[model samples]
Target: MKIKMKKFGVLLFAFLGLVSCSDDDDANVDPPFEGQSKSYDLTEVGESGVSGTATFDENEDGSVTITLDLDGTSEGVMHPAHIHFNSAAEGGEIALSLEPVDGDTGISETTVEMLDDKETEISFEDLMDFDGYINVHASADDLETLVAQTDIGGNALTGESVSYDLAEVDVEGVSGTATFYERENGETLVELDLEGTTEGNSHPAHIHMGSVEDAPGDIAITLTSVDGASGMSFTNVAMTDGTDDEEGTAVSYEDLIAYDGYINVHASADNLATLAAQGNIGANATEE
Candidate 1:
């Protein structure tokens, strides 16, 4: 019960950071979370570690760190592990990576800075917005483990009641992340972050159905542009069905949540169908 309570408190803190509390002063207010850094010892859930740390700093620059103590049970080799988006129930692709430890027992760390450019250049604000979590994948196989799960929380200087991060596409010749943080008054807004995008022809992007941790039922969302390796991106994706719409092209909101899907940015210059930086769209309503 205590562990559950503590985890709940963290989730609440994330909620608070996203939006302000209700106006009723007399209303019962949950105790303010005392920001602190804590460590978690992961276990062998499937083929990787099952634990890490979710640090909530009182200072605005604090970020949540996920450390994986991997088992080097495999013969001499550097196993691949990444922090992916989605639930363990429905698997998704890799979003970030933990410092890999080779051999038998190794420790990989993924410290997601709340307000800095660290591991994946992702912000705590953005991560918290998706009800996000950490996923550690098997080195050689497709099997994976949902290591950490929680929402973003905190009180920053922004005075805004929104939880999410939006950055520009900056990949010059490799992988990158393209996302839309929120929709303001109906005009859809998104950002294309290319930090390692390969230079070549544009590739197709999609907002497939379902959450990261669940199986996708269908492709519900589509993008209106393709990305280049020069950190260039475009938007204005049609989210609804239309007449003369290309087959398997456009989708809708109902289709968005029906199946577990996410924002898939495909790589064109290199691997034909390979993904670059993929993440979930939006989380749940956190405001009270």
Candidate 2:
């Protein structure tokens, strides 16, 4: 009976030692991280049919993980991507290089804590206010061809926009609409979508100082030329054209919405007298 009791005492001591070790191990293990994430949609560029979402995940260590998931990529081909410094409408330099997306899986993941220069540290918080855009290229050989792109951070669209009709003036059937989209940074993106334009010609567009009913007015703002092939034009409006005496006047989305102006799409740069489309905007816009 004495021997049996001693053996039982030894077993109990071993069991207690095991429990203590288990507790120690549990204390040493790190806890799961709880962080936030942001996602931005990348739209298809030039009928590439490749579109995706760029997701930025904030890590507990103050780093960021960027993931790109695209659709319609060709199998076995890799696509290069990067973050550019300005709005997509206003092209800019590459700010950060990203991982190449695998065409077969159409996915890419990269962990970054710094810009391409390595000296500029960009945290997840900094990305929230970044004035930049993303571009995914077709490949290393064709970097100029963008498969997918988007305006992120401060350059993103605010979902508030105004559109004005562009009636045919000189041309019988050439007409379209001009839309002004508000940006998060208070700027505006002017997009012109037209139909019945000549296939190979380029049309000059502008916003004049007065209404179309008041005859012609001085050009208040110069916009991007409309491409006849695609019948689309994208312009970033930040200021008015600068003259010899003074600098360009600063313009914002708010100022544009209440300004007195008119839009004209000319047939060509040489033929300024001929109008492809004309419309009254701002205060002169007719309620319909």
State which candidate has the highest lDDT.
2
lDDT of each residue in 19-96, candidate 2, tens digit only? 999999999999898888999999999999999899999998899999999999999899999999989988999999
lDDT of 1 by residue, 1-288 (tens): 999999999999988865655545436766656554433233344334343433422324555665555443354644455545543223346566556545455555566652222444455445544322344445455434333332122111122222222222223244445444322222233445556545665766666566545734355655643556455454433244334656444433233323244566665536535655555655521223
Q: What is the number of backbone collisions in each predicted candidate, taken in the order shown?
A: 35, 0
Write down the TM-score for model 2. Answer: 0.87
- Residue ranges of candidate 2 with Cα displaced over 4 Å: 1-33
Steric clash pairs (candidate 2): none
lDDT for residue 228 in candidate 2, whole number 0-100:
93
